[model samples]
Structure formats: C-alpha cells, structure tokens
Target: MGTFSDPTFRDLMAQRPFLRLWAARLAGTSANQMLMVALGWQMYDLTGSAWDLGLIGLYQFVPALTLTLWAGHVVDRHHRGRIVAACLATQCIAAIVLMAASRGHWASRELLLGMSLVFGSVRAFQMTAQQALTPLLVPMNLLQRAMAFSAAGTQVAIIGGPALGGLVFVFGADKVYGLGAALLAVSCILILLLRYTYVALPREPASLATVLAGVRFIWQHKVVLGAVSLDLFAVLLGGAVALLPMFARDILHVGPEGLGLLRAAPAVGAVIVSVVLSRWPLRQHVGRTLLIAVALFGLCMVVFGLSTSFLMSLLALGVSGGADMVNVVIRQTLVQMETPDTMRGRVGAVNSVFIGASNQLGEFESGATAALLGPVGSVVAGGIGTILVAISWRHLFPALAKRDGLQAR
Candidate 1:
C-alpha cells in the first residue's frame, strides 16, 4: 500500500495547483453524491412512485445531453477555474433552496425536478471545464499519476457520500441538503483559490461547425475514437449496476444492507487500484493494457452473474472495479495527452457525452435485458458481449491496439 510519505505521493502533492483542484473535485463530487441520495429519497417519499423517481434522472439527463456541446465551447473560450467555481456556486444555491423547502414543508416533486434540471445544466459546463483544466495544472509526465490520484479521491467520495447521507438522514433530509450546501460552498472556494495561466483562445463565433467540432475531432482521431467508444460499448453491455437491487433482494437474499455493500464493492476495488497506479503508473504497452483490463472487467462481470455466493459476487465486483480503474486511468491520460490544449475542452466534452451515454444508457439496457432474459442471463449475455467488443476492437482500431504508451507520439 502506498503511503503519504511515498515519493510518488509527495511528488504529486508538490503540485500545489493540482492539489487544490483535486481537493475541490473531491468536495464537489461528495456533495453531488449526497444530493442525489437526498433527492431520490425525498422524491420517492413525496410521490411514492418509481416512475417519478425515474423522471428525476430523465430531467437531469435531458438538459445535460442538450447543452454539453455548447458547454464545451464555453469552457475552451473562458476561464475554466471560474467556470468550475460558478458551477459549484450554482449547486450550492440549489442545495440551499432544497434545504429551505424541506424545512418549510414546501418541498414538492416539481421543485425537486426543477433543481435536477439546474444540476444537470451546471454539470455539463463543470465537467467540461474541469477536464480541460487538469492538464494545465501539472507537468505532462505526471499527468497519469495525477489522474490516478484524482480517481482515488472521486472513488472515496462516491463510496462515502451516500453512506454519510444515509447516516445524516436520521436528522432529516433538510439536514442532508444543508450539509451538501456547506460542502459545495467549500468546493467553490477552493476552486476560486486555484491558480493557473489561462491562454485565451481566439473566440470563435458559435455555429453548427464550432459546436460540433468536438464530435468531428473524435470521429477524425481513430485512437481517441476507439478508446472512447470502447468504454461506451463495454459498459453499455457489461454493466450490472442497474440490476444490483434485484441481486440483493432475490439472488443474494441480503436485502438493503447487502445492497449497499454490493454497490460499494466496485468503488472499493477502484480506490485500491487507483492508489497503486498513482504510485507505480503504467510504463508501457498501455493500449494492450487497456484492452486487457476491459476484458478482465467483462470476465469479472460474468463471474458475478453466475455466482450464487454473496462473497463471490462481492469479489467479482471488486475485481471488476479494479479493472475499470485501470481502463479509466489509461483512457483519460491517453485522451488528454493526445489532444492539444486548444481542443482538449471540445474533445473532453465529446468524451463526457460518451461517458454519460454509457452510464445512463447502460442502466436502461440492463433493465430492459433483465426484463426479457432475467438478471443472470442479462448480465451473462452483456459480459459476453463486452468481451467480444474488446476482442473486435483489437482488429477494428489497429492504431489504438498497437499504441504502446500513454504519452502522445
């Protein structure tokens, strides 16, 4: 296990600007996770309908999808730090509004849905700005390690946030919202404190061509296109997260608490692997490593689908998370390193769309397949599909497959 005293950790921590950026991301992500839990619980409490709960996600997704391209354009042309801080501030305001509504007994389904829209909109820009800013904060050689560290922080937040929210719920949802607001406020301050030299690109007029430049860039770069698409199809087919509830209740017979453990399994694995990677990093044959990691992820999912034992299932999910962390670190480092600074925001924007699509659409795909083939069959088939996709990509995108390093040639 790597410790804070490790030279690698010490080197990364020495990058003061990236440290602040990483801390800000950790705080902001934790707040976002808490907000999602509170929103879901409160919305269900109000409407008592699963469909309404589904609508909340839809409300968020629709706005993010519609605005993400423009968000990229804005990120490239403006101050990324200020943009991130502003997004956090917007989220802070939303949390405060939720807190007031909950305490005043005026919280309603419409109000929650509206706030979801605000979150989704702000996230489109925030995500774009953050991605574009990371490369600017650290030296190129340390970028992968920095990304790994960032992933570790994000995984920790994802694991702890909901658990913290659940604990705070004993006091009431308003308290949860209040806590989320405080966290967002802190994140906003940290981002504002961030220092970087921003090279202002020539402002291009907003046009269909300018807005769609990100899409065009991805389409043109075969290696980037393959990496991005690999994630999309792999997770879209292989993801079992949506069926976790069914597994906990029916297959595992562990109920709600077991469900929480199952959900945390992947994140736990991810965090461990992230820490290791931050220290060691990937030195060579990174493309093949990425492919192998995806394949391993699929195999883990296959084991998880077939296993009847809770411990086995947890083990499978944990390994899958580790595999995913490997994939994430490589792909992110590759994309950011390969793209020029002027285009990183746009490329990152397109990359964000791919990620968002894979997650949201992956869940929908899982649920639909589960309805038809049952959960086990759905997961097994998806895992098999993912493996096949990885194998096919080795041939389909030779540039990506043959690529040997995270650094751009």
Candidate 2:
C-alpha cells in the first residue's frame, strides 16, 4: 500500500498505455545496448584498430544524418506507434541476420558495418516517432515525471544490456545477436499493443519549405536550441566513449567482462539519479542546473581520462554519468514542453540529428585523435574541450542561462 504512495511510480502504473510504452522502450533499448557492446568488441577483436572502431560510429551516423529530415516528416504524418513497431521489427530482422552470419563464421568487418548502417537508418525514423509520441501518452502536468521514469527505464537497460552482452559473448557472439533479436521482437509486440493516434498537422506539399521548418523552429527557440546544442557540442568534444574498448582491453587489462562493467558504470550512476528525479523533479534555475551538471560532467571526464586504476576509473565515469542524467532530463523536458504537438516530430528530429551527430562524429573524433595522440591524451584533451564548450555556451545562450524553471514559457 505504501508503495502506491510514490507519485511517480503510481502515475506510471495508472497509465496502462504509458506503462506499455515504457516496457517496450526498456526492451528495445536493452537490445540495442547489448548489440552495441557486441559490435564494439567484435570490431576491436577483428581489426585491432581504433580507426576501424571509429568507422562503426561513422557507418551508423551517415544514414541517420541523411534520412533524418525525411524521416521526421513521415513521422509527423503517420501513426507513431505503428512506425516504432515496424522499426523494431526491422531491427530484429537485422539482428537475426547478424546472428546467422556470426553463427556461420561469416561475420566480418564489412558485414558489421553494413548492419550498423541499416540499424542507424531505422533508428533515425524510430527515434523521431518515439520522442513525439511520449508527450501524447500522459497528462501535461506529469510529463516531467514521465520523462524521468522513461529515462530510468533506459538507464536500467543500459545497466543490464552490456553485462548481459558480455556474459552472452562468452558463449558466442552469435548468441548475443540472437538474444538481441529476441528482445527486439518483444519490444515490437509491446509497442503494437499501445493505444493512441497522433493528431497530425495538415499535410503540406513536400517541399524544402515544409521540411526545413523544424530547423528554423529550433534556431528560433533559444532555450531549446541552446540546450540541444550544448549537449551536442559538449559530447561531441568529449569523446570518451569512443576509446572505451581500448581502455577495457589494452589499458585496464580486462577482457569483455571488464568492458561490460565499464559500459555499465555510467548507467549505474544514471539510474540512481533518474529514480531520485522521478520522486522530486528539479524546479528552480533549471537552466543553470543543466549548465553546472554539464561542467561537472566535463570535470569527471578529465578525472576518468587520467585514472589508471579500474575502480577509480569506474567512479569517475559513474559521476560523469550522473551529471549527464541531469542534462538529459531537463533538456528533454524543455524540448517537449515548449513545442506544440504539430511541431513535436519535426523538432524532435532536429534534436535527434544533433544527438546522433555528437555521438557518431564524436566517436570518429576520438578514434582519430587517439591515433594521433594516444588514448590517454585524446581523452584528456576532449575533456578540456568539453569544459570550454560549457563556458562558451553559457555566455552565448543567455536565454537558457537566464531561465528559471522547467515549465513552458
């Protein structure tokens, strides 16, 4: 009975549709994370080259960046749930193909990179639809809490996915892909069960004018633009994730299991913060809060880059992750709350591109720099760059810095 008193949990449970969506997200995210771990490990194992590892990120990024605008337009005019379900099914098929390839001893760098391209394209559309659909599932007042809970679910997947992937990899890489396919299947089923229809805007003729509206909207909304761009460039410059496999194998002297632990550490810290935020949302000086958190994230990156001891590195990463969680919750809430329903898909698309670019391009930057400066120097320089980005953004986006709360203006 006392458990029901928890407002975040209670609200999440009360809404069956939201619950279903949450579960589906958990399944899909976990599978994706697991697959990522497998892919990274496999790439490193096969090529033994950091440049090849960065190519994995590049392969994924290209499709997303190219198709993102068109995908967002499609999402705005379609049944979002069906779109998500279809995307999940496609990903499942891709995973099954990877499993067959790996099991048959036919998996190669080219095949893995090709799969990354496919999944990245599907995800470009899926992410826009899913992000747009979220605000429609729950009441307006509960949106922040819902986002917190949703992020918590993602954090949980992040925690379990790599660990599971690592454990399953011991059996075989094929087994990891097989499990990913299964989870993706489950995710598709869950999304198909959700009940909601989007209130689509009047369909305008396909033109640059229509497609480019989202870009203009984001540029005009200083808070949204600033928040998204802050995350974009900060993460772009702080490319710690790209060098993770190198750390796990060469630096830390730990195997796949250690890689899993390193991947999971940030999520472990993130889930804790998400749970807390769900219970008590941030209410004041939200913009400043995000800035401070990002700065802290940069500082922690510096610590993580310099650390040699495994435990100390994990601690540094965990703290960095906790700080990132703050950025995610507030930034997303602002984007959703500020935008109208008609514009959500398009706006979300812009945000997704920024995010995708940061991660994938960041990976490329990391790998390239690691080749030139070594992993330790590359990471430390990136951390210093992140700190500078934060300071620069604060001065540039005065509207974001001056904001007082998460509520829509």
Top-TM-score structure, candidate number:
1
Error of 2 at 30 (Å): 1.9
Q: Write the per-residue lDDT of candidate 1 for residues 1-409, one digit (tens) a residue.
A: 4356677668788999999999999999999999999999999999999999998899989889888988988888889999999999999999999999999999999999999999999999999999989999999988999999999999999999988998898899999999999999999999999988988888888788988898898898999999999999988999999999999999999988899899999999999999999988998898899999999999999999999999999999999999999999999999999899988888898999999989999999999999999999999999999999999999999999988878876
Cα lDDT computed for each candidate against the true fold: 0.93, 0.88
lDDT of 2 at 333: 96
The local distance difference test score of model 1 is 0.93
lDDT tens digits by residue: candidate 2, 174-211: 99999999999999999999987556567677678777
TM-score of 1: 0.98
- How many Å off is the CA of 283 in candidate 1? 0.6
- TM-scores, all candidates, are 0.98, 0.88
Worst 10 residues of 2 by lDDT: 1-10
Q: List residue ranges in candidate 1 displaced over 4 A.
A: 1-8
Model 1 / residue 312 / CA error / Å: 0.5
Model 2 per-residue lDDT at 128:
95
